[model samples]
Target: MSQFSRLFWIEWKKLFADKTIRKVVFLVPIIYLTLFGFLYSEEKVTNIPTVVVDADQSELSRELYRGFDADETFGLIGTVPTEEEALRWIDEGEASIALMIPAGLEQNIKAGRGAEVLTVIDGSNMMISNTAVRAANTVVKTISAGATLKKLEAQGSWGDEGMALYTGIDFRYRVLYNPTFSYLSFMVFGLAGTVLQQVLFLGIALSVAQEKEQGTWQTSVATNSFFAITASKLLPYLLAGTLNMFIGFTLLLKGFGVPYAGSTVDLMVVATAFNLAVLCVGYMISYFFKDQLQSTQIAMMIAVPSFMLSGFTWPFLSMPTAVAAIGKSLPLTYFLDGVREILTKGHGLSAVGHDLLVLAFMSVVSLFVAYLIYTFQKRKTAGTQAESTIG
Candidate 1:
């Protein structure tokens, strides 16, 4: 017990005893969060550029233009006389969408014959296209519905029963968790997980590999029991990683107002489990490579692809079979999936049960592999009988 305590303190001392580890683990993540927080500060996109082509030259066309102007989503650029002029605005990137009212639209509507309104939307950018398309559709749908109801009233059909003949069903949708559909709230949580995984992996990987890089393990820690040294090293990082998780959660929930709908205990458990899995993997990586830079290179390389493959920004199911199989093997992929459900959908432990089990199994399997590598290396080093100048 005393030996364990001494080894633990040595591990802690070694960490603060170096400046680089302190900065990378503590300061870098905070910097990342602060910069990313601003990206989503304004939770929505507004005033999307739109244009109108009013060939009708009548009251109906003018009313349609007003509707587009009134919506916060659409910022009407200018009215043009021809389809060619409106198409030019879209091609030049001046407008995201355009509504064209045909010349005889008002005349056809007045005569109880429906008129076609052409809507041209830029499909290149999904984000802008989604908002612009919805706004345009709303304007068209509202006007058409009002005109149809009026025509029915004029023909002596009235009330909900009469309207049912024209409209089969009134489908009302309720957005439960994210009522406002703020994109910031959606993105912040996903990115928080991504950044956390990268930093923690790097921190733990560097810890083990750096000792060999600086020759400290040969002179100092090599005298210590192998299990004690490994345990002591892992404990410090586990604690630090857990604390970092809470700090990240605070920033996302308290700072950015992203919802935290799951049990606090559940969040902590998952976070700690994820940290252990990564730390175990880090140890395996540290054992495989002889140099600190080499371990970090491998880690960062894996880190780059982890986010894309994690099903956070993209759907895992939609990915190619081989690519998605690679993603499924990663710890972050499962953690991100569970985090999304717990934070956004307010799901409990049962909801994320499969992912939780997979994460725990990953941690156990990695720890076993790391332990085997550690013992095998220790045996081989003893067999080598290599003399160290520092010792």
Candidate 2:
């Protein structure tokens, strides 16, 4: 066989034949997908704990309380006498939402005047806050329509005319991209990508570190040119990462029912760039840390915060400037954003060109750095071989 083929086979064995590396490459990703998939399977946030502050004590006020109680998105734990008490409940973490009905609510509605219902939501957790706010708005709109219908009926306009008048301006809405607003769809793809990234980094770092620890790395560097060794070492990881990405996509579409609306070519392009960049990152880690354990530890340290820093769940600009800068330096940030645009928005490669460029840039710069490191090592290894031959 050719030298390149032999080096490829050697690297493949070094990566997959080892039990620990094999598990890190394959098993850990499966576990991460299963765990995070089930965690978000319910699809939507529901049953937010709520407190009602009803000062009116009127039948209309009670009816308003029933509106909140009937909403599946809210679970009314109890009623309180004052807004202050409800505020206390929210402050103490006893409830996520509070509904306040004022004393003149029934009087104002009967007099055909504007009545206000206050919805106070804890904004500490954005998911819960947004869910509670949406549910509250829906409930309030429904109740307001019912009240308007009753007033129109009392005025003897109880027909289609009443509905038309009540629904003035005809506010119709359409939800795009994600009609169901499923948390699973919103979260799963990014999470799976993050896991894939971490696993690939760990596997690459450990494989290189193991070679260095066993003193086999020098021999490989001594025999092959820098380009040949680099290609052979990276090829195994590139293939493995692509396979894992395929598995993740299958699980997303089949197991979790997440949609894939982009071109396969586009997906592959981004995946290839992301894989190359991540492998280079691992290569850098292996070079900096000589010990296998130290390299693995460094890999984990970088992998752990990558998702959070990737701006997947949170807005990138909303993060602290320093934090966002750190996130900008990581390849996962660009990869996840580009994948999301394709998968969720059904955008083509054109929409994600910027992200693709960033990943490509990262790959190029990192590969250059790795090449420089390899050249330095190659010179040292050649000198050692020359010295031994002379002796």
Candidate 3:
């Protein structure tokens, strides 16, 4: 075998030779994918416990309660006499959603003064809030429409013309992207990134650090320059990590029926840039630490927080300024949102221009950092060798 081929196979074998490394590099990612996949496997959130306070004491309020009970997303737990009690239930963890049919609600509707149903929901858990608010809004709208139509019919207005007269300025809206509104579609991008980042960081961090520990850094230095060694060390991991991310995302979309309506070319471009940035950071950490364990820890430092800060689950605006600024430094904060826009929003390259530019900048910066770190490592290694020779 040629030198390159021999070295490549050696790197490949190094992955499986250690049973602990094998499990961490492969099995941990799979475990996270399947576990999180199953957690959000249900496309829509359901059975969110809810409580209602009926101050109206009218047929309309009672009818509205029945509607909420019949809706699959909500389960009517109990009724309270006051809105304060309803709010207390939410705060006490007894309910996730609450409603108060205000006093004189039916009277106002009957007199054409307009009625409003006050909905108080715990916004702490975003998924539950989304599901509860959506379901509750549907119930309220349905009740209002049905009652309006019935009242108009009594005045000899009926059918399409009556609906048109009463329903002027209709509040119809479109989801724009994520037509199905599947949770899997919402979370798939972040999950795929989570798995990819973990393995890539773990694999690349261990690459040079393990070699240095085993006294093979000299062999690598003898054969190649610092840049060449860094590239060679990362090549096997880059290929495997890229392939693994692609297959994982493919299965996530196909198996779970998540929607993906975007250009494959766009996805490939962003994925490659993100992979490069992450691998470079890992390589920098690898050269910074001669111990594999310390290198792995440093590389993984960003892994847990990246997903949370990536604007995948949480809005970047909601975070503190310093935290948000730090999040922007990570390639994932841009990549996740960019990929999501492409897949869910049906955005073209032009639409995600800012995201692409940020990722490109990160790739360049990380590569430069890795090269500088490698240079420092080389100089330090040389100084240590000379000192030992003189002694």
Candidate 4:
């Protein structure tokens, strides 16, 4: 074989030879995909427990209470006698939504005046809060329309015209990006970044540990250029991370019907750039820590917050401005945006050009900085060893 081909084969074999590396490479993807895919698959809000406090002991109030129970979206878990008890249910997580029918609700409806129904929703969980708001609005509108129709019928003026007059504008709701609002489609993009994070962490930690265990890291630094040593350490992981991306997108997403609408080429390009940037981060972390255990701990600490702040589950726009700015600084945010655009909206390269550019810039910057740090450390170590020999 040619010299370059022989070297490549040696490096590839070295990577596969480590039993721990082999197991992690094969298993991390499966664990992440299964956990995230199954947990956040269906987006439907079904059977959320809710509490209703009905102070208005009237037919209209009772009917409204019945309406909530009748809807499949909600289950009436308790009828609290007081507002404080209902609020307690929400605080304790026993209920997601609380309906407070004010004391004069029926009297106000009978007098041709509308009474405000207080809906206290738990906003701590954004998804549940959104679902609760939608359900509450729906039930209130239904009750109002029914009351209006009955009033019109009693006056002998009930007709299509009267109904139209009572309900002036009919609402037509349209959900963008994901028309079906499938959580899997939204989550798959985030999961891609998550898988990349795990792979990068495992690759870097194992690569560093393997070098230490084999004593190759010291031998290589003694014989080769610093640049060559860094490249040898980084290149393999980059290639492995790239391959993992293809496997994840093809097998878990496309094969499983995750509804990819965006340009596949664009998604691949952005994913490649983002993975490289994060891999550099992994290398930097490993360089600072001597052992695999410390590296793993640091990786977990960094990964969890980065994932949460990426605006995958909770929108960045809705967060506090300062918190949103922090999220924007993360590389995963751009990756998440680009992937979602492609998967759900079927966006083209041109549509997500800005995000791709940001990811590319970040990758270049991170790799350059990591190379500098690695080279500087190697030079420092060599200088110290030379001084010791001269002494």
- Reference-based lDDT, each prediction: 0.70, 0.76, 0.72, 0.70
**lDDT (tens digit, per residue) of candidate 2 on 1-391:** 9999999999999898886677777876775575445444555666778898889999877887898888877889999988889887875557867888878877877776777787877553456656766778787778778777777878898678765754211112223345455777777877888899998889888888889899899888878887787787789999999998988887788787777666766777788889988998887778777878778767876787778677676544345556668788998998887777677656688878888898888878877888888889989989988999999
Q: Backbone clashes in each candidate structure, one number apiece?
A: 0, 0, 0, 3
Check candidate 2 and list the clashing pairs.
Answer: none
Give candidates' CA RMSD values in order.
Answer: 15.5, 13.9, 13.3, 13.7
C-alpha RMSD (angstroms) for model 2: 13.9
Pairs of colliding residues, candidate 3: none
> Clashes in model 1: which pairs?
none
Model 4 residue runs over 4 Å out of place are 1-165, 213-219
Q: Give the alpha carbon lDDT tens digit for every residue of 1-391 in model 3.
A: 8999999999899998976678778876775575345434454667778888889888988888888889988878999998788877875557867877778887778777756787777553456666666778888888878877778878887777674854211222223244345666677678788878888888888877888899988666644686678668778787887788678777877777677778867877778777877887777667677788778766776686678666466544345556667677887877786776677655677767888888777767777887787666667777878898999
Stretches > 4 Å off in candidate 1: 1-172, 218-226, 386-391
Write model 4 residue lDDT over 300-355, tens digit each, in one string: 65575667667667654345556667667777888887776566556577767878
Q: Following a full C-alpha superposition, what root-mean-square deviation does model 1 have from the true structure?
A: 15.5
